[model samples]
Target: MRISLMSTTLAQGVIDWSRDGHVLTAEQKKFYEREGYIVIRNVVPQYELDRYQKRFMEICKMKGVAQSMTVMRDMTIARSEYVPGEKAIMKVQDFGDDPILFDYCKYPAIVDTVKDLIGTPNSNLLAMHTMLINKPPDSGSLTSRHPMHQDLQYFPFRPADFICCSWTAMEKITRANGCLVVVPRTHKGPLLPHEYPKWEGGVNPMYHGIQSYDPKMPRLHVEMEAGDTVFFHPLLIHGSGTNRTNGFRKAISCHYANDDLCRYVDIDKNQEFTANEILDVARKRMKKYGMSEEEAKAVQIDFADIWRLRARAVNGVRQHL
Candidate 1:
């Protein structure tokens, strides 16, 4: 924890993230408050990780229909028959409807840490988003690099302080394998505007990134062993490197919030910019599959509506998303 102790916050009775004694130790909380993230070693056992990996592989192989799951194809390999099944996929997002995959969100080890970070000791929990990311070896196109962006940009929720993301390494993650790169303490800042980067190789669908960031900001590459889980703030500026290794890099993650304490927020003009982009993708998908324009238009979906459709109760009662 690099943050200096403050007497002013105490004077104002405004103790926010740091608390002494919980699922997270005082030291861990202090580090998270200062760095916007904390890595918990060996939180998930190897066997459990194997299950998640197997399930992801099953989805990739098209073993069964994973209802409502969006399989984002890597733009570089999307049209090539050379790369089959799993090799062509970049991410499997919104898997909350899949029971086997959703098990990752229900694991006690992850739940406790999420509850601790969200300041909800024993309350209803909602999984706002779930993803199984597969970063394949870059083919000199730099398509594997995920641009640095805040998770909050895509979320329409109030009191951003109560939400966080938990990411688990399914295998050894190193800089060579495109491990997560984080800008520490950036979570304290406001959510900046986001837009798709103009990469020579196009980005995956809905892969919006912040337009600009401090070039001088130091980036910490988070290297982790298999089964290590990390919890981070929603506003933290983070992204992954390009996978230079031949092997594909795998990781699973979920954005969590205390549903009992959270409420949907209206998207302002700036947020609508990115929101419409996401909506356009969905609209195109519907029309591509032969849905008439009038029929697709009748569907009526918004940024908040999309989240409401995805948000599911991970723990406790789900009164509202």
Candidate 2:
């Protein structure tokens, strides 16, 4: 919550060599500065691009993960469809054990682009989650668009939106297939929240206590081509629409954060951020509200639970079953 921004260790390498045009051209840089996001077309070469996508699909099939039109890859989708007896999604964190996927993350182009945006050559892969949207020719599942919200809404530790994501297009992403849309310049303000979506019953993606945006905010849909990547501020609000086209939409989302000021926390709970190293920040916030110790502890425990669940979800390694 109130932690300092991630350190400049990673940022140092970036400033030494990067320019605005390598990933984001001058015009695009201007666009990003004004709007909060830029579409970096072909940040990844076609060859390396194909390698990662192919490896992920094989891992999915070997693990026996069901192919569904509606779910994204990564632990979130795997965990959502997880049966107690079955294997889960292939975690990219464990990619060290495999050569192909491991090499994919270390690709120079990817790292350079990250260095350009985050000002850090030492950037670590915060998360590597893939999404596969399969739709039939005529009939397919229809889900609501992801509510507009900032990535920083989930992780408040990073100083000012010093985060980046690259969603590689495995297949062509068209408007009919639900490409991502983002609000320009929305990242400059504090995060706004949306109503938590109740997927089936009450089980759904945790909103991380984010409230929806003001009704009058401006918005845009980011229509991207296959093999292109879009980068944005972590605080920028973004989401995609449902796939209405006949074909499937497949993409891998790679998240990165500044090494300094970044900490692993449960995004679902009301995490506390104290200015100093005080153990009683929670108690103090509660005291200001006249809450008894028991009530404070209850909130802390709930916050801790959400934090822990998300932690398990974050760095755990899941390979193909």
Maximum-TM-score candidate: 1
1-321 in candidate 1: lDDT tens per residue?
112221122212222455663578777877887788999999889998889888887888767645568887788888777667668778999999888889999999899887777655676889999999999999889989999988888887755666789999999999999999999999888788888889898786667788886757998999999999889988899998999999989999999977766677776455787788778877877887889998888887877778888898987788767
**C-alpha positional error of residue 276 in candidate 1 after TM-score superposition, expressed in Å:** 0.6
Query: Alpha carbon lDDT of residue 199, candidate 2?
Result: 44
The window of 10 residues in a row where model 2 has the poorest summed lDDT is 312-321
Q: lDDT tens digits, residues 1-321, model 2? A: 333334233344344322454554556555655577777776567787578667665665554322211222322334355433112332332343345654544556665665566644444434332233232222232342454566654453444444666666656777787778787877766645445554442322332324545547677777777677777777777776666775556565555554442454433232332112123543555666688877876664443332222221122232210
Task: Write down the lDDT of every candidate, Cα atoms only.
Answer: 0.82, 0.50
Candidate 1 TM-score to native: 0.91
Top lDDT hit:
1
Summed over model 1, clashes come to 0
Model 2: how far is 294 from its true place, Å?
A: 22
Off by over 4 Å in 2: 1-27, 64-99, 102-104, 120-141, 198-204, 207-210, 214-216, 260-321
Candidate 2 CA-lDDT value: 0.50
The worst-scoring run of ten residues by lDDT in candidate 1 lies at: 1-10
